[model samples]
Target: MNRREWGLTTLAGLTGLALPRATSAQSAGTGRGYRYVHLDVFTDRRLAGNQLLVFVQPAGLDTDAMQALTRESNYSECTFVWPPEQPGTDHRVRIFGRTAEMPFAGHPTIGTAFALAHAGVLKPAMSKTVFGLGVGPTHIDLEWKGRQLAFAWMTQLKPTFGKTVDDAGGLAAAIGLEKDAVIRPAQEVHTGSTFLIVPLATRKAVDAAVLDRAKVDAVLTAAGVQRRGLYVFSTERGQDDATAYSRLLGSGGIEDPATGSAAGPAGSYAVKHGLVPSDRAASIIFLQGVLVRRPSRIHVNVASAGSEIASVKVGGTSVVVGEGSMSV
Candidate 1:
C-alpha cells in the first residue's frame, strides 16, 4: 500500500483498538500536547513485535518527563527525538526505559526512524537517516517499497567479547534450566549493550528457561563479569525461517520481546564460536518473544575478516500501529 493509504488504515485499526483520545479540555489544561507515534518493530504486522512509543516533538519534555512518559506508556521503552546536536546527524534521540535512560537500544532506534519517516519528518526518497544517540551517531539505512518504508538497518558498534562462564550448572540454575540444556559456555558479549550470550540445546530449552534474578547476579559476580541481561538462544531450528530461536531475560526479571542490541552481539558470538557458518558474510535471523506471544524477527548480518568480526548490521521492518498525543 502507499504511505497515505497505509496511514489511514493504521488509524482505523487504532480506533478499533480503543486507544485513548485526548479531549480539548485536557489539552487546554496542559497547555501543549506532544504528538507521539506507536510502532511495532522487528515485525511487519501491527501489535505483534516489540512496542515502541516515539515522541516526534518533545521540545519541552525534560529527561525526567521522558522517563515518566515511558513508564506511563508501559512499553519496554520510548524515545524522544530532538533537533540534531551533531553536525552530520539528522536528529538526536534519547532512549528511556521505565526507570532510567539508556545509551542505546535496538528496537527503539529502528522504530523511531520508522515513526519519523511515517510522520514525514524524514523525506520519503531519502535512503538513510542518522540519529545522535547516547552511544554517539548511529547510521540507519532505509529501504523503500514504492511509497512505503520496507526496512531499516542500523550499524551497531564493534563487538567486544569478555570473560566466559564455564560453570554450566550455575548458569543453568540461574535460568531455571538443566545443566545439559546449556550446550556451550556462557560468555559476555557487548555491541551497543552487554549481554551474556547463552547457547541452549533446543528451542524448548530456550523457552522453558526462567530467570532467577538473585541466582543470576551471583553467577555473574562469580564469573567476574559485569551484570547484564541474558540472551539465550538455540540454533537447532527444524523448519523455522530464523537461524536461531532466542529470548532476553533482563536482570530485573523483565523479558524483552525483541532485542536489537543483543542481536548484534549474538550474531558475533555465533560466528566466532562456529554456531553458524562463518565461511562468508552470514545473515542470522533470530526469532524472539515467542513465549510472550509477541513474536519478533530480528535480522543480524555479520561480516568477518578471517577470524575477527569486521561489521555487524541489525535490520528489520516495523509497522505504524497507532498515534496519539500526550499533554505535557
Candidate 2:
C-alpha cells in the first residue's frame, strides 16, 4: 500500500477508532434531516462514473479537519458543504485531494448538486445551483423527472489557454506510453487551474498509460501547471464533426473518468488539427473511461472565427453515487 494509505490505516488501527461510516444521518433540525446522495459522474450507470463523497450541512467541520477527513475518505477528491449561512450564497463548498486541499473539481460540482437534490434541499428545484467555491462560483442545472431531480448539468469555469507542450512522443513516455500513441503538438489546457494536455493516438493508449508521477510533476512544475493532463482520441469522430472523440486523465494518482476542463481545450485541438471539420464552429464528444470499466461521456464545444478560435466549453451529467460521515 502507498504511504498515505498505510499511515491512515495505521492511525485508524492505533486509535481503535474507525472512520465514521459513510451513512446518511438526520440534519440537526426540528424537521429537515441530513441525507447522503451518491452521484456517478460522466456515466449513465451506477459505479460507471467517478465515485464522489459528499457531506451536506457540514457547518461544524473546520478546514483543517475537513482536509484530514478527505485523506480518510481517500477518493480522488472529496467535497463538503456548509448550508447557506447567509442570503445570496447557496452553499460553502470545500474541496480536498487525498493529500491536500484543491480550489475546485468538476465531478464534485455535479455530484454535489445532485446530492442536494437527493436530500431535498433543492425541492422547489430551480434550473440550477450556483455553488460558491474558493476560486469563485460554478453553476449546476437540474433535470426533473416528475418532481424528482434525476440529472444535473454543470457549467464549468471559464477556460484558460496556456502554452502548448508540442512534444507528444516525450510526454507519452512521461506517462509510460509508447511514441506512436502520442498525439502531436499537444497543448496545456485549464479552466481556473492549469493542466498539461498530451493527446494520444488512440483511446487504447490512454487506457494503458500509467503516469510516472515524478516525471509528470517535474514537467508540470516547471511549466506552472497545477497538474499533468492526458487526452486520448478515437479516430471515429462522433457527435458534431468539429471536435474529435477523446478522453482526459489528470496528475492525481487516480485517473479522472472524464475531464470537462480538458474537454474544453481538446475540442479546439480537433478543430485546429483537422480531425474535426470546424470551418465554422467546433463541438464534439469526448468518450472516456470505457477502458477502466467506468463508461463516461463528456461534451465539448469550440467557437472558431475564421482562422482563429474564440472560445471553448465542456458539459456533462454527474450522477450522485454515495455519501459519508467524517469524524476524524
Candidate 3:
C-alpha cells in the first residue's frame, strides 16, 4: 500500500498486528529498558480524554531511537528523559514525534507532570508546580480527581501571533470548500509550536473537510509554513464555556484528536478577533476531539491587560490508562 493510501484512510485503517514490536538487538536486562505510564488528559471522565505514553526515567535512549519509538507508537507525541532526573538532577524532559523533537506539546506536558507527581518527584504546591522542559520551565497544578491524579491548571508558554498567510482561498478550494468558507488570511499562532489558524464557516464545514496531503503540502510549501499549518475549526455558535467546540487537523500526515498547544493559541486568536468578551483575562473551556471521537476538553485562559494583550494558559485533566516495561 502507498503512503497516500494511508493518508487518505481514516485512523481505523492502521489498527493491526503491525504496530508494536520488540527489536531483537537489545536484551530486556540492559540498563536500557523503559517504563510506561498511561495518561488520560483534558477531561475528568475516563476514556473521554487525550491518551499519553509516559516513559519514566528513560535515561539511556539516544535521539534517533527515541524519535523512532514515537513513530512506532504513532501517537500524537511522546516524551523521554536523558539523565532521568534523579534525587537532585534537573529533569530534562524531551518531546518527540515521527519527525523531530517538538519544543512543547500540551498533553505530553500534562502527562509528564502527572507522572512526576505520582512518582513523588516534584514538590507539591497548593496552586501549581513549575516543571522544567527542554524548551523551558512550565507550571502545572495537580489535584486529586476522585482518587486519581489530575491537573487542575497548567500555565503555557508565551504566545507568538505572526503573519496571516495570504492563501486562505487556495487552501479552502483545495479542501473541497468554497473559497469564502476559509477564514481570511490564516494567522500563525503559537504558545509552544506555531499553527496556522484557518477558521471554517460552520461545524458542517469542519465535518466535511477533505484536506488532501498533496494540496496542503503544495499550499504550505508555497507559503513556506512547512512542518506546521495545523487546521482547527469550532462548532461554537455563540461562545460560552459548555458551547466552545473545536478540532485540530494536521496537514502533515498526522491528526491530533486533542491539541492543547494549538488550542491555547486559538484562544489567543479568539481574543484578538473579539470573539470572546475580554473580562480581565478569563479562563474558558474548549471542547475538542468530538468529530474525531476522542472527546477532549481543554481549558484556556486569555489575559488582556487593557488591550495590551497578555499570557495564554491551557491545561487539562489526565488519567493513567496503561503501562508497560520496554527493553530499549
Which candidate should be chosen as best, given lDDT against the real structure?
1
The TM-scores of all predictions, comma-separated, are: 0.90, 0.73, 0.78
lDDT of 1 by residue, 22-120 (tens): 899865687477899999999999878999999998998888888888999999899999999999998999999988999999999999989998998
Instruction: Please count the clashing residue pairs in each candidate, in the order shown.
Output: 0, 8, 2
Candidate 2 wrongly placed segments (more than 4 Å): 1-35, 84-89, 176-180, 213-227, 235-253, 272-274, 279-283, 303-313, 320-328
Please identify which of the two predictions, 1 or 3, would achieve the higher TM-score against the true structure.
Answer: 1
Clashing pairs in 2: 27-34, 38-320, 38-321, 38-322, 39-319, 39-320, 39-321, 40-319
Question: How many backbone collisions does model 1 have?
Answer: 0
State how far residue 43 of model 3 sits from its true place (Å): 2.5
lDDT of 2 by residue, 1-328 (tens): 9999999999889799755654455333233223335578766678887777787766666778777666766667778887654456688777777888777776777677767777778874487677777767666667787776766665555445667665556667777877667757666666655555565666556567776778766665655556655565655544443234555654544566766656665666666667677643333667776666686777666676677666555555666555644453
- lDDT (Cα, 0-100) at 118 in candidate 1: 91
Candidate 1 vs candidate 2: which has greater lDDT?
1
User: How far out, in Å, is residue 99 in model 2?
Assistant: 1.7
Per-candidate local distance difference test: 0.90, 0.65, 0.71
Regions of candidate 1 where Cα sits further than 4 Å from its true position: 1-28, 250-253, 279-281
For model 1, what is the alpha-carbon lDDT of residue 1? 98
lDDT of 2 at 195: 59
Measured by TM-score, how close is model 3 to the native structure? 0.78
